[model samples]
Target: MTSHQPPLWRRAVAEMLGTALLVCIVVGSGIAAQQLSPNDVGLQLLQNSTATVLGLTVLILMFGPVSGAHFNPVVSLADWLLGRRSRTGLTLAELGTYVVAQMVGGIGGSVLANAMFEVGTSISAKDRATAGTLLGEVVATAGLVLLIFSLAATRRGILAAPAVGAYIGAAYWFTSSTSFANPAVTVGRIFSDTFAGIAPSSVPGFVLAQLVGAAVGVGLLVLLFPAASRMADDVVVPHPSQKDGS
Candidate 1:
């Protein structure tokens, strides 16, 4: 750790807490949307997307300084990959812990949302894993990675809060899968049997698609911003991770 930098334990807590809150917002809002607009699926989506956009932006701003507000496995993985050459972002050991924390947070968040909505914690029956939806995951994840890294590479990481939120909001409307770009979020949804839930059978395909999309995002980053690695430490937000040299 460096001056003004938090310890690894604190960073881990931030990651878990942030991811948990993110999933909470997603699942909670989805449930609310369904109840508020029971007759209009489109209206429900609008409510969900709007809440997500605002909530995500606030979460990023709240946690960015601590852990970069990854809230997603792909984001953390990409950061590790990009920073390996420069030793700026997460190390291999840190990546492992971060991933574990995110997964735990995601599951906890899902359960919390279920409790809040008075819903049972059961496997979702919503079968969304179709060829088209899988393809949508690809598009959504690719765009997310591309956008996040692009902002950092261009030295506009300061805009990450609103920009990332806006992109996700738009993707919710544009993509077929409703833009569950984050693998943690994807898995979390499986625990809820609400409007935001996904069937366990569909998770593998969605996860696979997200991985492919992340690779595509990296490919595009390299092509469009060859020097993107220079900013790998700053994805989503510039944090002490890169500077702590962990």
Candidate 2:
């Protein structure tokens, strides 16, 4: 085996590529479910839920070591705020690259889905509507951030990646928005003309809700585990968890 460290560029690129892959699995699954059986709402939802759970598990297990598999800006921001993610600060350049890569990956996924099913380009109403939908997003996102900080922040939970996937997957059903906790992923879904797509007008509300959820989760985390603030920085990898210490 060889030992070498990935530069910051490689780490950031990994983040971008991992996020894109995650969005594809999530949004792409929804598109497939719709095309296969539009009338079977129950079956479609089940398929969507199953795919999201399985895909997230795979992504996390694969990329969690690579880029922390953040896939969601809120998760990244929360980690940074708590000092869990300090290697690559949330500078304009970093944020620009992350958002752009995520969007590009999302669009690519949507396009692939569209080509497969011959569907038109448009956001799905169920994915962008209010009431249960929006509320679900806020709650799901909050819970997700809360879980990440609580579990993944410490070395004790480094192996809890699978649990994190299951958390989000189950939250999708309980949450009104089917667990669209990630702002980046949310934005990408808008481009897909599938059951998981969000309307443009509804983007703000979802983002706002997700942010709020993150804040709330952070607050509770602080209260429950006051020591987190002191220990958050310990989670970062030296040289991006390089195969060999640089």
Candidate 3:
């Protein structure tokens, strides 16, 4: 039996909704963490990361089948680039749609989160600009892409959801920039003034770093998993074959 695949519009809506929710979890949890753990920075981070991990996992599980649960522009672009030769991944038009949806959803999510807490819409005052933080963003994003593609390449696609959530959770603690690996998420973060927010002035550097990291990730994938036997249909979403006991 062939599994029912959603149309482009439905898939696009899923991507937008999924990304919006992801940002909500991130920013909302950060706000909650700050308020709940005012005295201890470590506790705040711990709370924030925990919520993100669980929330991300749920989102992937919920939307992976419909739209691959991308929620991140770099992931979508990388998927397209890697699968261009096979012609089985996202088309150029689909890629554009995904990116735009993600960006818009991210911004909307930030706004929603801020409004929920009655914080009102305000630009982030937190400045994350610095050589070290920039380096951290590069490293964080590179590791994320590498991990994602590597899993897909190695036929470990089923593990993508949990593994990705776990990696991001760990990265939050290890990376200096707290691992804002998604460019869309980074852009959304600028609109919030909470703990997870980044200053508008700092956005460009972080985005550039993430793009550079994506390139590095592709290089690393080439070096490490030169010839994968099969490619997953989507990074986080399992293909029909994986779902129907094929």
Candidate 4:
């Protein structure tokens, strides 16, 4: 039995909406955490990370089947690269579309969150540029990609939502940069001046770090799981053939 994949337009819409909601959760929770825990930076991070963990898990579960729920440019790019040989991954056009949708959705989500909190759109003043933070972004993003594809390689794709969410939550505390790990989300964070915000000047570095990390992750995936497997389009939700003994 073959799975009925949605049209490209429909999948694009799913990516847009999912990415928007993910950023909304990130920016909104940061704003809320600031208001709630004004003095304690530790507490603020705890609250923000908790919210992100839950929000990301839910969003992936909700949209994984539709668009693979990438919500991150690097992840989509990695998928395209890994599946290119087999023609099972995204085409170039689809990759471009997904990246555009994710970036636009991230920006829109930041704006929406700011408007909801009655804080007009403002550029973040928080400069997150430092050697330590840059390295942290690289580590965080690489680990994320490794985790995602590792699960696919092992046919443990069903655990992706929880696994990815849990890893992000943990990376928040371990990594110096709080594990932004996503270029689109990093861009969105530039629009909010709250706890999760990153300065515009710092965006380029973070994005570059993430790209480098993605490359590292892909390398690790190849070295660790050298054998080629049918990587799932949506790691959290298997296709029909995977589900049924076709």
What tens digits encode model 2's per-residue C-alpha lDDT throughout 1-246? 564445446556777676677777777777888879899987888888888888877766676555556667786676556653344324445455555665666666666666656777666564365876767777887788777667644545564467777887788778767788877877777777577787778888888888988898888888876655544432222124323332
Please report the candidate that would top lDDT against the real structure: 1
Compute each candidate's TM-score over C-alphas. Answer: 0.96, 0.82, 0.93, 0.94
Candidate 3 local accuracy as lDDT?
A: 0.86
**lDDT of all the models against the reference?**
0.89, 0.67, 0.86, 0.86
Backbone clashes under 3 angstroms, per model:
0, 2, 0, 0
Best by TM-score: 1
What ranges in model 3 sit over 4 Å off? Answer: 1-3, 228-232, 240-246
- Model 1 lDDT tens row, 141-173: 999999999999998998999999999999999
Model 2 Cα displacement at 141 (Å)? Answer: 0.9
Q: Which residue pairs clash within candidate 4?
A: none
What's the residue-level lDDT of 166 in candidate 3? Answer: 97
Between 3 and 4, whose lDDT is larger? 4
